[model samples]
Target: MSAPPYHPVVPANPADADAIVACWWTLMAVHGPIDGRMYETVPDAQRVYREHVRRQIDASKGVVLVAPTPDEQGIKGYLLGGLGQRSKVYAVREVGMIFDVAVHPDHRRQGVGEALVQAALRRFRLRGLSDVQVTWSPENRLAHGFWQKMGFAPLLIEAYRKL
Candidate 1:
């Protein structure tokens, strides 16, 4: 049989919450071990997404792109990003900030993440944003490697100390 056909990128709708959540959980499972935190309970993740991300998407300043199965039965990966004014040393202007990009374990190494990033970049260009940035935990070396391979260089580093 021929290899399964995959749609690398597709616009996400509010109805995509379930699929998006699934992808999010998968990512958390992968990274949580290094951070020493338990994976977020499903309800907690859902609440946060609904309260924050869903509203941003509805407001048109945010987007969630998904790579779904060929028949669109379920999503295998997703990228969430938003358009906003970012304060930079030079000036403040619209920029695209990618909050999350995740691909299911089975779909890893299949170019899904790259496709989603490209799609988000295209959307940012259409919105006239000047730049795009993604932030990930310092422990996530895999993500750092991926971003580097995508031609992104670290522009800033942040540190914090608790009193």
Candidate 2:
């Protein structure tokens, strides 16, 4: 088979926040079906999320990456990650946290998502992070398989109950 199309992953600028948020919502849509309660959103979610993305773009510890579409008109995927700290008691005080990642449906399985992640990992390494973590619903097959394939093993299991 021919090689998957190559889309260069680049650091996102403030202007890319809209596109990045769009991808985020797409990812959330996938998760919503898997578990509505777990992925519920507020009325102002888009606006709130857009602001969050812009803040990350400006934050020193944050890493926001995007893969531009083949034509360069828009982004095909995005990954949001950043440096995070655990309680001071932990030996691993600082860690890398991948907040979100999403590839447009049309671009799935073509390496866009992986490329975005790999780029973020490189950035994390540059900032002296030794551990990177991502959380996704266990019921989402695509997420489960993809993260596992990317070498992540369960470090914690979050249990939730509805009242």
Candidate 3:
């Protein structure tokens, strides 16, 4: 079968914030079922996320990449990446963090996600970063497998409990 045509991943602008937030909610829908406590969506998640996405787009150390739908009227996926620093004790100073990534259901398995990841990796490399990190819910099997397939391994495990 022929693969669906997809647009090249490109840097996002303020105009893309709404689409990215829509993609984020799509991610939450999948994850909320995996861990309700951790993925709880607030009543104003859309508004909050829209603001956050706009900030990320304007952040000097951040990169937001999006894959536009074939018609170019909307986005099929997005990736949020940024540069971060480890504690002074850690030798790795500058690290690339893949803050969030999501692809609409219709575009899944069509290379949209991978393309976003590869584009982010290239941006990190160009920025001289050798280490990158991403976090995902352990029970989100799709994310676990996708991140692993992208060559990311577990480096930290966050534990939690209700106090």
- Write the residue-wise lDDT of candidate 3 on 125-158 in tens digits: 9999998999988888888999999999998899
lDDT of 1 by residue, 1-163 (tens): 9764445788887887778877887777877676543343555766686566567557678878888878788887999888767557657467888999999888888888988888899998898877888877778889989999887889899765546
Q: What's the distance in Å from true for residue 26, model 1?
A: 1.4
Measured with C-alpha atoms, the lDDT of residue 27 in candidate 3 is 89
State the displacement of the C-alpha of residue 97, model 3, in Å, after optimal TM-score superposition: 0.3
Q: Model 2 clash pairs? A: none
Q: 64-139, model 2: which lDDT tens digit per residue?
A: 9999987877899999989898998999999999989999888899888888888988888988889998998888
- Tell me the deviation in Å of residue 65 in model 3: 0.5
Query: Model 2 residue 37 lDDT?
Result: 83
Q: Who is ahead in lDDT, 2 or 3?
A: 3
Model 2 whole-model lDDT (C-alpha atoms): 0.90
After superposing candidate 1 on the true structure, give the runs of residues whose Cα lies further than 4 Å from its correct spot: 1-6, 37-43
Off by over 4 Å in 3: 1-7
Q: What lDDT would each prediction earn against the true structure?
A: 0.79, 0.90, 0.91
Instruction: Spell out the clash pairs found in candidate 1.
Output: none
**lDDT-sorted candidate list, best first:** 3, 2, 1
Candidate 1, TM-score vs. the true structure?
A: 0.85
Cα shift from native, residue 116, model 3 (Å):
0.2
Total backbone clashes of candidate 1, pairs 3 or more residues apart or in separate chains: 0
